[model samples]
Target chain A: MRLPPILVYVLRRLAIGLVVLFGISAVAFSMAYLLPSDPVTSRYPDITNEQRAEMRRQMGLDQPLVVQYARYMESVFRGEFGRSFGTGNSVVQDLAQRIPATLELASFGIAFGVLVGIPLGLVAAVRRGKPTDHLVRVVNIAIQSVPAFWLGVVLIFLLYFQWRLVPSPIGRLSPMFISPPPVTGFLTIDALLAGKPDIAFAALRQLMLPALVLGLGVVSPLARITRSAMGESLGEDYVTFGRALGLRPRQVVLGDAFRGALVPIVTTLGFVVANVLAGAAIVETVFAWPGIGRYAVTAITTSDMAPVSTCILLIASSVAVTNLIVDLSYALIDPRIRHEYAR
Target chain B: MGEKLFEIQNLSIDTRRGGVTRRIVENMNLAVERGQIYGLVGESGSGKSISMMASVGLAAPGLLVRSGEVGFGGRRLPASDQKGLRGNLSHGVSLLFQNAKGALSPFLTTGRQVERVLAQRKVPKPARPKEITELFRLVGLNFADLGEKYPHQISGGQAQRVAMACAMASNPALLIADEPTTALDVTTERELLRFLTRICRERDMAIVLIAHNLSLVSEYCSGLSIMHAGQVVEEGALRSIFATPLHPYTKGLIAAVPDVDEPHELVPLEGSVWGGRNDIVRCRFSHRCPHVRARCEAGLPPAIARGGHQVHCVLYEGEAA
Candidate 1:
């Protein structure tokens, strides 16, 4: 038996989507390569001839350019994401250690953003001229324009310096005691499992500035988009159909309004993730967080192209995967847009 | 009080434009009796759709109701308050949008979508299973396997039936079909309406069938209201309106339809409906009303009722002139 037309379209799109992603990765990778500075030379000033030769052999850098490229692709396909030249550790291991933190931050930030922003946006749309709407708009504008780095710095200065409310950013954990073997690899989760409130609090304190900075930056744009989308959806013909059916305001908003709102929200997620990744690099360095972004910057400064490649792939894959998920969800959120293909 | 199942009394809609208010639909009134199909016929932007949407309190953002009292089931419609209206009207009233494909939720299965309507209205637990099966059967759909299918799996006609089934889920007192068959092919349109007529007859459902097609309503509607520029230019029994269209716009619309028996030349209405962001002292149709007189532009015309037919035109001011 054959699958449906929409399913076929979805599969075709997935195939096409993969090709498009590959092309995007190629362009981004090429640009990264073209940028000035290599990480190896910046880190190691005095390298003996033997050390240089050993490093070359270890990196497979002495091989022809085509040979190196082929090997990189081969390893990438098998999930052996090369080694970090700066720390001389497996890139996979580094990723395994850092991914959970970045993801936790990004996911939490999005959840927080959507939870807060959607309501604010709805308020802005419903009460367009009222003081509440104006205040939200003003706040959104402020949040949108302020740089995440600057915002993070200010939050730390005020919340950390004056109040001494949050725990110090001691790299995903506290300095007061020893920790377990980092099961789950998320400090908060690990802290909970170990029943150590100190570690959990430390983890939360470290997480606060990053999550706030990331979530804050996203809240404005997300809220604005959600508001406008809700407004637009509320005006759609079907919403009238809903009202004519005598649906409640809450019903109209959730069933009718929210359905229409997803198109923008899904599209916005792509931009949000891009912003988060970019911010991740800067934020990681700022907080001295031992994440991939921090490692990537260090690897780049030392011209460790292998680890840099891994980082590039990680970010690229993340963006591609997120975009794909959002695309798939479009058909789910709105029943009107029937997919030509889905698997 | 009991003559008509629904009555729109002096309905008017106002829209804000550039900080100025202008009337869109003014003092429009119509009656839809139980077991009667009332067709609302008009060209695009003639306020036909807006009138019905507004009458049911479905006016979207930016469009405000200047004045109106829509009464159904002995209670004045709470158009101004959406919260107050939901419980009373929602389960009792269902609207079929123009685009069948666009109207139904794309994500949900046809059965599930129909089930949601049943669920939201909180259909009694015992009656639900039996009712679901009966509804599917009535709409010419078999739930044996097809009910599991999504909107994409079905044809346009089937999707419409599914939508109809959804609208009929709670066994509504009124079924408001806004161009239900416009998206369907002729054969399918005919088939769907036949099914609709059958169901209405069996269920005693009052239908407010809105459409641009005058002939379509002529065939189905027992009564009809003709709208032009947000006003009911003419309204009466379908047969009466067809026999002698009181309004010039109605006359033009009837004239435009191709008749096999008459075999007459088609005369399309000359201009489009008026669209501007300005106030009007005179009649809106005056800009396009072929029977326009100098005095017709002086003030807003009243809906002159004679022998149960109302035509908002200066020519009808005299008794049966």
Candidate 2:
């Protein structure tokens, strides 16, 4: 009996992802361990050297490097990422509270980028060498070159400071409204599920600028990739064949050329998503958003090694998951690629 | 000869490259009669494919039809009327381009591709599946094994057959095949050509066979026009033209074809076709003609009629024999 090839491919990818996660965690932990600033000293600056040694013994940091690595792996296996010395909370617990905010921001950013970018690319490709094509390229380049942090600030100044078109970007919600109970930990969804449109709207309003800035930063590559791919696909003999068959221009471009152009776009989407997720840190810090990226910054600034390493591991895992999904979806969308999975 | 079904007269195509406009095809004429295989043979850049593309409105990007008139199904078609061309040609004319594998949408199954064209042509929903299966069979392919296969899954011959099936799905009256067998093996090419000939005879459909292979065209086509540098150098019945070749360029083309029965050294034609000479008033083929004369470069030569044949050359000034 033979197993389905797709399942085999998925399993192979899962095994590789697990290995990658393990490697990331080990390297992060090793780097943090070798850092000059000890976690005990950072947490308890006023304590004597004797007390510090006692604290190190209790925390098992006084052990050999191999033993410490084994102990760290044991804790990680148990879903424990140790405790943040600065905040005195479990790193996993802090991550659980903050990961949703990062996910929401990144998701919106990428969704906005893709939604706007693909259509613009199609238009640019079809109107190649025309004024519309030139306009789209210039806009795409401008959006890509503008730094997200700067864009966030400018947007804040115009929308919030000058025109007063939006609410203050104090955080996810105003002080007047308390957050809804965490269900999926995503504020907008949780608020909607809790039947509070006001809360959801406020959270969304606060999310708009940062996501927009990050999304616009990504739009250039998406649009450029889409345009080039579409242009090349349009030149393909199949497209000519489609047109010769007397199929409408709409069908030829959207149905045949678009699908042919999608493989490259989809491959690019994975990198874009990963970049968005990783890039959320700077945007979060600039906007004072309560996300894992902001939390990671705080941990790094305060020299909290556990939380920083934990954040690294989590991000690596997410990237791995994204790549797997992209790879699997590639097979699903294009049958030509699906055959490669057959074993 | 069958009734005249399609024609392209005074067809001139221009293309712009690096800010300079140039004529790629000029004052070309072709007429395809019903049930007749009309071969348009020329070397690579001689407008054989471009002329057919212009008739079907599938000319390569950036090519403009400067002046031409296409006649299809007794109706006159204005140049640049793409909408009219597409609508009129959809039912009557279908093209089979070179590189059968590339001609197919790689993502679609061969059956699905045929079904798409059938559906677009408004074949009844209930009959499409059966009709598609029958078409596959008509092209000597199995519906079950090959229908679900993508373009790359099939062999080159099978792919060409699949293309033929798709072309026939609309029951087109005219099939413009542009070097359809160039990419296949010799055996496969022969097989595909035989299939094309059978379809032409059985369905009474006119075909414009565009190819550089003179021998292949000689075997299949009844009437043909020889093109060089965007102009038709000779036009006539294939048998008559082969017997009494008039134009020097035409003679060179025949001499280049290798013969197994009476082996002779292949005499390759000297000089290359000038691609972008739109301003030249002389004959386009004069530079490459062995019988080049001072008068050949002075002005364009008129077509000298020889019975049912015609040759455009200064050497055939007033000879009627």
User: Candidates' DockQ values?
Assistant: 0.35, 0.68
Candidate 1: where is the Cα deviation over 4 Å? A1-96, A122-134, A228-232, A247-252, A304-306, A327-339, B77-79, B82-88, B248-259, B262-278, B287-294, B298-308, B316-321
Reference-based TM-score, model 1:
0.85
Model 2 segments more than 4 A misplaced = B258-266, B275-277
lDDT of 2 at B178: 87
lDDT of 2 by residue, B11-38 (tens): 9888988988888787888888998999
**lDDT string, candidate 1, B1-321, tens digits:** 236788888887888868888788877888888878889988888888777777666676688877767787778764565344444556577788878766666556877777767777788777777787788999998977668887777888888888888888867888888889988899999999999998999999989998988878888888888887777888887777788777788888888999988899999888788775446667777788788999887655676776556677788787664
Report lDDT (Cα) of residue B121, candidate 1. Answer: 78
Per-chain TM-score of candidate 2, chain B = 0.96
Give DockQ: model 2: 0.68
Task: State which docking tier applies to candidate 1.
Answer: acceptable
Q: Which is the leading candidate under lDDT?
A: 2
CA lDDT, candidate 2, residue B210: 90
The worst-scoring run of ten residues by lDDT in candidate 2 chain A lies at A334-343
